[model samples]
Target: MDTPLSVLFSSAEDEKYVLDCMAYFMILMAACTFVCLLFKDASYGRYSSSKYGFLVNAKLAWFVQELPAFLLPVCLLIWASSAKSSLLANQLLIAMYMCHYTQRSLIYPFLIRGGKPTPFLPFFLAVVFCTYNGYMQIRYLSHYADYPADWVTNPCFIAALSWFVAGSALWLLGWLINLHSDHILRNLRGPGESGYKIPRGGMFEYVSAANYFGEITEWAGFAVAGQSVHSAAFAIFTAVVLSSRAFSHHKWYLAKFEDYPKTRKALIPFLV
Candidate 1:
């Protein structure tokens, strides 16, 4: 009996080719997303509209859509033949990928307070991206990634693995910033109060989308640490989407409040 993986990739070379194609596809998707967002705001959260057809509960949608990214890697490692998973370099890369998804899938959604429902189309599209990306990143790391035994220690591989050691600090800092920014946003409303309020302190003082900045930084650092085309593509995709979202958020904040700060940028500090 042929398994799905076997059917999709007959040999290791085939798998590598497919993964390369997928990374390029992600880059293309990122470009298309940026172009599309320029014309219309994505229908979710403050931008949610009825004409999008159906809406899914925000928490449910978040968890369900994000779950695949968390689960698929585990599935690939356990059931699929992943040769490099035991290697130190691959293990570290997989660990970094898992850490982000674990927080995203398990911890983030349930913490929501009066969050807006997601449009069905957006929710569905998110699921597709998660499923697609999860497979691409993990499959390559676990199965196709080939690094030398001293990749992490050798000066020659510093371009790839040394960055993993160096970028780990940046990744950790971004993760902490992301966590703190989310905490600030969640606590913005009082116990009984409703609706959005201007987030203060943390990254909020400098930018409207502090959370967005943190996540983008997180992935940019992840790309450096990962030193793979797939990770780089993902980081690009994250910046394009989140930066656009942040700009929308900045526009909304400026339009809604007469007292909004004039010096604050959208996604970046001091400059957009």
Candidate 2:
């Protein structure tokens, strides 16, 4: 049997490279954390006075947290590919990274129909966590893992490719649903809105937090394609964190909107 990739790190150069990558990764993460804090402060105001105990807009908070987390993997893929000259893995990883960022960059800002930026505390926490995980991921990928030279030609590779394709399709579908829902709701409210209300139609018909659900699915599919513990962990973390947020939103919706959709589930469809 092939030895697990984790047991493959045997060289001093590999170890040193991993350490260097980790140190740089940490610095980058710190910068992202600082930026997030600044955005949080500027966008949401001070954390103490906010209703949700932070200054971020509720709808945008999930992306704010996810953005840095998304960056770490991309950075890792870039560094690993450059250092190791592994064209196939590097390209695949880059594609995965770009797929996520493309959606984030193109779709996220517009999704904020209207709300303050995320609160400083949650934003800060997300940055820190993402940075930490990013560092860990780069460090590990640099030394401890290996993939097939003909990874793209392999059957498993094809399956992973399919997973990626499916995931991407789902992500796009979710994005459109999220966008439409936000559009409808935004037009309905017509700016200067506050407080939670029942978001209807689109994916919201099936899940109360359709946008969050889309985001979670997108990351989860990315992880499935990459097939890395780091990626999987990030996906799982995204799911758990977003699920909690969805639940919070669900509860808030029910409390605030008397006629909220009783049929919709929180994070999942047809299940909790």
Candidate 3:
């Protein structure tokens, strides 16, 4: 016998049911993330070990995991019928998501320099997450979601648009910082050199995990702009995961480097 949830998911016609399921799943994921905070995900950088069994090149791992976020949306749009005269704002929001994933999946992985091997487990988890999230966001925004025809001139819409603009600006700024910070970390080693170095300059002067901060900020802004449960869930997830990683990185830095800056925080500039 087909369960109600299973039937809803299997049917292409029940878009609302699918989105509700996605929302519920995100809520569950948020709870799971809280539990996961008690234990670190054992992959990436110094944490990488053979305990998880089997590893893939970091670049390959990142590319494959992130690919679904970019590709699934494109595929969905091509095959799924869209609402006629879809709001321009919705289209732009979809573009923003695609832009972020395009960079993450295609550009950022290639830019990585001598990254540590990623364990198969975490890599697989990431792929599943990206695919699930990509489908939820793209399908809702492109096909099912609708806005008032007068939304462009409505005061609420105007305010939401402003919120989105502000969020996008913050997101873009954070992305630039993240890219620059990654570049600095990548160059910390020479052709034959392989070891950790205290990252200096830019946001690193104040925070041990500047790139993490940038990413967290980016998604948080996206959530604010998006003003949807789906976006909010993603933002919360990012914050929880990245903040945990930043704390771990901070602890590792403190233990490893005797001359590490005493004033620098973990993810936040000075608060955390």
* Number of the top TM-score candidate: 1
**Residue ranges of candidate 3 with Cα displaced over 4 Å:** 1-13, 149-156
Model 3 lowest lDDT segment of ten: 1-10
Per-candidate local distance difference test = 0.88, 0.60, 0.80
Question: How much does candidate 1 score in TM-score?
Answer: 0.95
Candidate 1 residue-wise lDDT, 63-167, digit = tens: 999999999877887787655777888888888889999999999999998888998899999999999999999988887777876788788875776678777
Where is model 1 more than 4 Å wrong at Cα? Answer: 1-3, 159-161
Clashing pairs in 2: 55-118, 55-119, 56-117, 56-118, 56-119, 57-117
* Backbone clash count, each prediction separately: 0, 6, 0
TM-score of each: 0.95, 0.64, 0.90
Candidate 2 TM-score over all chains jointly: 0.64
List the candidate 2 regions with Cα displacement exceeding 4 Å.
Answer: 1-86, 102-107, 134-145, 155-188, 191-195
Model 3 lDDT, residue 60, Cα? 95
